[model samples]
Target chain A: MNTAILSGRELNYQYNRSQRQPEGGKAALANLSFDLFPGQFLALLGPNGAGKSTLFALLTQLLRLQQGDILVDGTSIRQARSAALKSMGVVFQQSTLDPDLTVIQNLNYYAALHGMSSREARARSLVELERLQLGDAAGKKIRHLNGGHQRRVEIARALLHRPRLLLLDEATAGLDLETRANINRHVRDLCQQQGIAVLWATHLIDEVEAADQVMILHRGNKLAQNRCEELLLEHHCDRLIDLFGRLTGTQTGELTT
Target chain B: MNLATASYCFLGIFKRELHRFLQQRARFASALVRPLLWLLVFAAGFRAALGIAIIPPYETYITYEVYITPGLVGIILLFNSMQSSLSMVYDREMGSMKVLLTSPMPRSYLLLCKILSTSLVSLLQVYTFLLIAALFDIVMPASGYFWLLPAVLLASLMLCSLGLLLSILIKQLENFAGVMNFVVFPMFFLSSALYPLWRMRESSEFIYLVCLYNPFTHAVELIRFALYASLNLPALGVTAAVTAVLLFAAISAYQPRNRPQRGKPPS
Candidate 1:
């Protein structure tokens, strides 16, 4: 098995809304490149329109690669789709779980999508639910759960396949501070214990801990990528918010704490 | 596409659709109710006003209830197609469609799976309608039941493909009602659903030709012929050709990696 779980080289994408564009030529992502190794927790930080979602779409094969290539576990996403998807799991910025389905049902359905048998799916679902502390909410409909619990269920569902690489796009957008911290700790623990390569994408600087690898994106370009401590040292800044504001050119508002 | 993978994908989507329908029992029942009202009450009143005509599939004179059974079947398939497409739009809005589209499977196969799943659900609803029709003594020839399966399946595929094609072209759910008004009623009324093509000819050969060309007409004719264990070669050919065209068009519109692009912020 390849140690490098996810790698993208010179990825480029453009959207041609013929009516809006000047002759319909607008680039969404340009020459973006990055690599994620096993057991590494990488945080992708960018402004709202900095192409982070576009990058996520490209990595997950949700958007076509107009230029460049991506390989998941040594298999090109375009050429070896089934094999690549089998080795990777993705959680989009928006919720994907069916509100009508129970927590257990949602996980089982996702397992079935990967061709698992009903019995195997149920067993895996139980294990994932237990891991996320959602075992008690297994029979409850997803609509009944609070936003934080729903987000946890989504994470647990993604882990059902035991994918070597887990991609989370804005996984904690609306969670309260305590809930976000709990989920973050759980995810970090999972990466350490299971050695799953994680690519966590978010715009919030607070989400990046003192120790994870950080990649800052601006205008579809990778401006900076290094250890959290190193980035702060390079920028002569102690707080992540200050560094982020400097990198992305955004004004900082009142601090949460 | 890989047939084995396609089969698995089809089964997975089909099962999910079935679960959804079962969970939303009111919607399923209401879907059946619309056609039932047309078959029992509407057909009952029209039976007296409408004159009898000698159709090939009918050995002798038949009531309007028996005559419109196939059309009622078409109605179920048509409504189900629109319903499935509506769900697709909803899925796109809710982000579940992204999950299915992002799967390693080919886009065409994924779409075919969606069509097949919706077709199966439509067929089930048709059977439920047929059972009720039987209770009301609006049954066809006893042997017609077996042949009805293939006819229903074909019609379901054709309608579902058309629905899939529509979903790809229409980007938003708001545009759906306009599609329903402009497409659904015209296809249903302009075809031989409520009246024979010959009857349409008496009204106007131009209208009759339009009916002959319409795929919905062939779908209805195919079911009508099968209701008597007879085959309509022309209807079969037309239905098959239309299905192929629509499926091709649908698959072309859906690219696995075609994500919504972000635009510049408003000035």
Candidate 2:
């Protein structure tokens, strides 16, 4: 029940901000480490500039792991890249779907990439689209859809392969409050119903629930990692947002330990 | 990925490229117009000015229109391949490339599929141009048209590989326009595309050497000879060798650094 589907160990990465500076001045992610258990939702709570997307990039193999290692479904990403990649799905921060193509076309293309037959691709895509309440818009171009709809299409596309691990990097950014909450809650339900591990990265404090596993990330540092309620209890805080506020803003939220 | 998966991946990429090419009506128009203008207007003007000696590809003195048709074919291919790759740069900027790179296949295999797909689309455009040229009475030998198919596909692959390499190396989409100018223009102008090397040699020995050494010259020679029901061994060797090198380099360089910067949440 506690088997980890995703494991990131001592991961470190630096952005080369300038040509003259050899190895870069500041590290984007410095010695970060965590594990995401199967059927569990890991909320990576971090503000802007908190190395959330960098970590996501590394996990998705969009960026090379500069230091340490990452494993997906017991396969090291650095070693067996294709096998590791086969085990996960990622919905990046930006809209990655081609605007000119219809939603179904995009989903079909993704299915083909994973070697699914056309019959199977259609079946799986229809199931995901219906679940996302996007069945009617399947034939419409991505550009014709609104932001919330487009995002929903992306989520459907991501899940068509039924990967064991799903990684979303600020997936609900810039949406309205209702849409944001809906997307957040929907993704949370996926972990429970589908038995898929999820690593959801976001800055919004309210996106996380009191029962979820939350990790506070700031300036490439993991400030705290525990259940939401336990973190509030341990930090002597009334709510999750206060702990988040204290840790992320100003002269740091000094941890009791 | 397994062989079956790789084949499916290739089919997906091929269909997507063909779909995109078909959707963009203006792209097809522009691709045809560029070559047609050179063939109809430019070649027509230069016919009397540029006399052709009996080139090897031509057993006798060929009309200037016939001589330049193969070069015009080269133009369509060079521009089409580069245009296909320019869309790659656009995909990078638009973040669709990240989606592609993250697919459950080897990066090298994915890139290879992309090259083949674009080459196939470019082939369609080339054949369309040939059909239009035939309508205008600029016809090659009957068998030459059939034989030119393989040569055209090979040339398109090499040119597409070069374009893909440029797309990877070109960091910004804005920088790609400048690169196309530097690469496409010099390749077309300095090659045996427009005029015979002997003609260039007569004008300037230095210019002749550049044309002789330019890989585009060999590409054109291959197409020209193939269109005349003949074969050029040297051109075939050069094109095949260069395709291997460029393809290897492009696939190898498509690592982390070559990928476009992801839209981070301001970190």
Q: Per-residue CA lDDT of candidate 1, range B194-250, in tens?
A: 988888999899999988888999999999999899999989999999999988878
List model 2 lDDT by residue over A60-94, tens digit each. Answer: 77786768899777678877887777788889888
Clashing pairs in 1: A63-B257, A64-B257
Please give each candidate's TM-score: 0.94, 0.95
User: Model 1 segments beyond 4 Å from truth?
Assistant: A1-3, A17-24, A253-257, B1-9, B257-267
- The CAPRI class of candidate 1 is acceptable
Write one digit per residue (lDDT tens) for candidate 2, span B58-152: 88888788998888888888998888788899988788888788887888888989988988888888889999999989888999988898998
lDDT of 1 by residue, A1-257 (tens): 44587888898777664435633556667788889999999998876777778888777766666789998877788788778887778888889888887888777667757666667778988998898888899999989999999999988888887888888888888789999888888888889999999999887778898889998887688888999999999999999778877876767442222
What TM-scores does chain A show, candidate by candidate in order? 0.93, 0.93
What DockQ, on C-alphas, does every prediction get? 0.43, 0.51
